[model samples]
Target: MEKIKPRNFFDRMQALDRRYIYLVVALSIILPLIIPFNSKTYVTEPTENVYKKIDSYAGRKDRAILMCFSHDASTMAELFPMEVAILRHCFERKIPVFTICFMPAAKPLMDYAIMTAKEDYNVQSGIDYLSFGYKPYGLFLPILLGMGDDISEAVETDDQGRKIDSLPIMKEIRNYNEMNLVIDFAASAAVYSWIIYARAKFGVNVAAGITAVMAADNYPYLQTGQLTGMLSGLKGAAEYEKLVDIFATHRDENGNIASREFSKEILKETWIKLSDIQDRRYKTARIGMNAQTVAHVMIIVFILLGNVGYFVTRKKDIEPTG
Candidate 1:
């Protein structure tokens, strides 16, 4: 039998179409999962600044967090982790959450979020948080939120067919004026609706978790102090996971690995990373890594290969084809 080995390290690393780099990246993340590598997370100065300010207003009896989903399946890759972690934190602390959807389809998505939150933390449904389904009317959103008792009076059932009045969580939440914090997970400029009607009109505190593409625009809101805190895409969610010591995906009760449920008070430190969250965020509809990130890497790879491929082919061309 002939022994085979590459003469050089570069040759050894060459991968035709095997996606060995992806395997390596996957292992870099997955090994940590199996071994439980412990690394203390650094509080990004941005999150710290937001944390101190957000922490100040927490723990109020009626203080609530309103998280909005203004996106479709395509944007979920970057948006869901941040949304889930923020929701977990709010529910764990017994903070009331009134999640809604400006995009309308977000209504079902929001319900899925609530169900996961409840199952993960064993949270009480109405007492802990409530998703008001996808209210189809964007124009009335402002009035529904800021119009006080009028909003609650009109909203009869929650997304799950529960009577809004019967919910212990909603029994007293009469208006947007009572909301302590508003966390908007947005994609396009659609979230501005909540900004104009909910926060500006009622003076409710606001925060946000937005996709990387849309995050730049929201910085103005942060600068204006219209938003108390914000998480920009998957990186922000990973940072938040480090803050709370949980993973987006975790081991199941039977020891089979699975996506971690959202729990405000997570007992076991989870393996929640932006990558893991992406798995759940897209769920049945995901493909691969972040497209932009992938493109950047491909660009670099191609640049190196171009230089090498050019030299190799040129050498062959210069030499006579005998």
Candidate 2:
């Protein structure tokens, strides 16, 4: 073994200031948001499956999609964009959509998605869309099962206490057969309830829109076809938004666009043209992805630098002294 020798470079590296690393990390998260830029999102298979499922109901009145918001403000950062994108797709494609909230606090988030997406076009509550807001937690399974018998008896009123059967849109959608798809958006394991009650009982197709952290736990369901599709965090939302941008972009007064013909073959070859988009709301997850990319890259770079410093200092310390 060689004698150790003192070296200025290794000494400086060993004494590096932690405050500098902290500053770099803080800047990594903030700078991207302050200076926003366009970023391309590669759509994943799970998210693409969600887009395809929603697209299948285009211009249909008898068949519809059910959205269940199971999250609150705490997880809005990941799940909100997903809600907006799905709503926009329904509006653009003229698909009948009904929103329900098992968690009381998620009602506001549900309202926000409707309010934001509807700003771009004319969407009426009783006619174009409907909401069953703030249903009790324990009653979720009962309400879901009850819908199979009579939707009106299970869900008696609208968010404002108007009769659900009185709504013009409700004339076509009556039971679980009419509402074929149920998508649960959550930050927790609440999706399991939907998978068990709504899907297992009535044979309704199930999907989930969830935060990235909880995504891994649900993959087994996807493989077994228990989940028809899923959206994981901001990245999944971004992918769904991109698909909607390319396909579902027009509708009629009754939410059916009979004349607007769409071809998936053409969309597959073309990149998403962000320049043509006017609504800034559709770009929320994309902008967030930019910030996430920068922060992740910065962390990897810092880790590499720290390791280099460690090895250099170790080599110097082990060298023979003069």
Quote the positional error of residue 274 for candidate 1 in Å: 12
Model 1, range 88-133, lDDT digits (tens) per residue? 6665555677776656667666776676656657566677777776
Assess candidate 2 and give its lDDT. Answer: 0.84
RMSD of each: 9.1, 4.1
Candidate 2 Cα deviation (angstroms), residue 158: 1.1
> Please, what are the lDDT tens digits per residue for candidate 2 over residues 52-87?
888888888888898999999999989999899999
TM-score (all chains, Cα) for each model: 0.64, 0.86
- Per lDDT, the best of the predicted structures is 2
Worst 10 residues of 2 by lDDT: 257-266
